[model samples]
Target chain A: MAKNQSEVSGIFTAGSKSKPSAAKPKNPFTHPLLLGSIFPLLLVVVWEVLSRLEVFPAYQLPAPSVILGTIAGMAEDGTLWGHVFITSYRVLMGFLLGTAAAVVLGSLVGFYKHAEALFDPLIQAFRSIPSLAWVPLFILWMGIGEPSKIAMIAVGVFFPVYLNIVSGIGGVDRKLIEVGKMYGLNMFQLVRRIILPASLPSFLVGLRSGLGLGWMFVVAAELMGASQGLGYLLVVGQNTLAPETIIASIVLFAVIGKLSDWILKKLETRTLHWQDRAAKS
Target chain B: MSLQLERVGRTFAGKPAVQDVSFRAEPGEIIGLLGTSGCGKSTLLRAISGLDNAYDGVIEINGKKVNGIQKTTGFMFQEPRLLPWLNVLDNVTFGLEGNREEKQKKAGRYLESVGLAGNEILYPKQLSGGMAQRVAIARALATSPEILLLDEPFSALDAFTKMQLQDLLLEVWRSYRSTMVLVTHDVDEAAYLCDRIIVLRGQPGTVEREIAITESRPRERGSSELAAYKAEILASLDLTTETA
Candidate 1:
């Protein structure tokens, strides 16, 4: 089917259609994304302006200019890309593998009644234990190599996805099943047509949760003897009191996590266009 | 082409929902099951449709015991229950087991048949209550079922919408001529739709009255014919009468 788009014709075109934008004074300064930076920018401005005006020692709080120069130097040495790429690759691999495993198992258990009963207790048992708790054990099992870190990341992200898909499938309306059976659908047809489609909304939510968990786990995963990731750089920078790199890495992760979620949300909207239409109006 | 329900009964949680119910429907005829709320008319219909297993009965379609949900059967639930993730067309053809393109073909024909030609792309929640119910009906007919079961499928609708659907349903019945069983609390609905009406009443629900609708087809509300059938069903709920 074509991607979901708003239909030109509908039942009520005028009903609660517009978004609620505040009718406040159009202050360019109060935009929230910029507002977060405003105070920090003001502090830096005061510090720099005062220092240039011979107010306090410039050594204590290096000007934003000094930080920018350090960032440029790191960028030129290619350390920034290497660290960022390593973290990104690990996150991507862990997220993809976890998602694939979760989707297959979750949907299977959810769709098949016997499977749901058989696996639900086991999954519940596994879920009760936190992924972080596995970090020490995984390190011992696989050493401080990529396997240990990825294992931690995989464990961290699996449950949200698995539970979501299972519940999503389970949550599919009984009426839909009746409809299928009434039409003479066999077992396979029921799952392919009725169960999976109905469960998609819950499944999508699970995937989004998995993405967030992956981002969280990757940061923790890099804490053990990783030499090249953003997390490793942050730790090294902290020991040397290079606060700028620490701040940069944290900011980078925030941006990347936010960006990753944004991409998933976009995918969700595009793929589940029918649900979006159902929700609006 | 007929259906027979012989000594059919159901119990849930040790409570008798329906018991000792027997009936038959001829080919191309509509049979109505009418009762008060909690009288187990729906339970009986579910047993006949093979949806409920906590029952004892021999349900035969064309003289063959229906072991389970028959391939020739279609059911419209009280709720539309269309998949929220699928469009009207997808919902209508959801039960069609085939390649995607073939299902679409059959779905389009059924949608057009149900007076939903242009609204194929809409979702269930996007449709009006009447429209969603119409999608349910379309989904039912897309299977081209030989027997159709309906359980208060239009009761949620406003009066006008309900009447409109009744007429739409009559038109489809005339065209397809499938044997149908409808369970409804509305006595008028049973009178208007069915060639035979069975009324259930009691703690352990049983058929207390069964009236054959000898009136002509294309029945009207407030007509003496329909009024008599309505009164007959209502009178069955007196609880003093013996089982039919």
Candidate 2:
């Protein structure tokens, strides 16, 4: 009765114990996380050396040091936080809105044939439209305001989440559903207990991809017209011919994008720990 | 509760799978539907469980006709079919209806009865095939249904594990006494566990013979009595070659 049920010590370790002799203590050097960064570190070192040697013009392509300096200068002036904050805020709002819409529409279409026939073709048609082509129309409709910017990002986020939800629900094992039916669960209980949890892995995959698209659309949104945001800095760097400023913004984008994705990946790992996966080699 | 299946028949896309399958399971009786592959043993079990209501005749439990899945019946599929997301304890409690604490308490007892005590924290993915099937059996019995239907529950297991589970099932049945209808192709399994063996044969299977097992509880696995029954069931199935 007093057991700690939440302890998940061996949760993610299954079906990979085929070779007992292969179960040596892991080598730190062979660790995937450590090994993955080496190539990127090498590239940075090469870029730093080449720029210092004046192999590239500073005006056209600045050194990594210069871009770091620009970023540090912005941080000192307090503008860095504001740009990062506003851009992230836009993406967050758009992500929430798009995810909500996708869940509603996707569940309906996935569960019912009539809903699929009624809405799927139209949604598919809209998906085929180039995301960038919506920029001018969105700007004209909402007048280059925060609404238009958020709306643009929402459009980008919607398709992936929607499509993934549909497929996820469709891909649910019929045998699992039969189990629910055998238990005499009603339709609502069946959906809540079986369908929702079964499709959750794909849903989370959709969320991560949707978030990535949200970041891409935020760049497009701010590029069209914006007073504050990292995307706006890209335009200012271009107009003022400051390559370091442009590169600094790009670096910030990469850092923040990777950071957000890392959070989502952590969440995915925690929730899907029950999945029977191959050992990480 | 006694179960009665009267002239039960099922067809898939105009092709008959089982026809005129009539049988009755007395209260606390273990009835085995024994057959070779494609003999519609599972089809008949499904119809009796009310999972397939499109069958040609009436299936009644306690004299009331079955409409759909019966609240008084529990079913075990060939595969464990444990929802991978739930741990052992939760999977055992999945079909139970009650307060959380009560459900867990009942689930704990059933898990222990199936010899899976102390492993409640483990998930289905971590369980070996036999262990997973033990959890499935625990889950099915947790509801304490008056009737339990099993579709080749031990068919996927290793020979040693299969024998151990067969004994475990009989042990559980001694206490719970749920009228069990087991569909199995294993001649030894049917002979070892059943009170009556209904041998089904051929496509669109129907009951070809019913062999009564009057040897009583705690019958030895490889006893001459059970071996004779196995031979009889095998002979009934081998007749399929000529009938087909």
Look at candidate 2 and tell me the lDDT of residue A242.
97
Q: Write the per-residue lDDT of candidate 1 for residues B148-179, one digit (tens) a residue.
A: 99999988876766877898899888889999
Off by over 4 Å in 2: A1-26, A31-33
Q: Between which residue pairs do clashes occur in model 2? A: none
Among all candidates shown, the one with the greatest lDDT: 2
**What is the alpha-carbon lDDT of model 1 when measured against the actual structure?**
0.80
Could you list the iRMS of every candidate? 8.2, 9.0
- Give me the candidate number with maximum TM-score: 2
True contacts kept of each: 0.47, 0.44
Per-model chain B TM-scores are 0.93, 0.96
lDDT of 2 by residue, A116-233 (tens): 9999999999999999899999999999889999999999999999999999999999999999998899999999999999999999999999999999999999999999999999
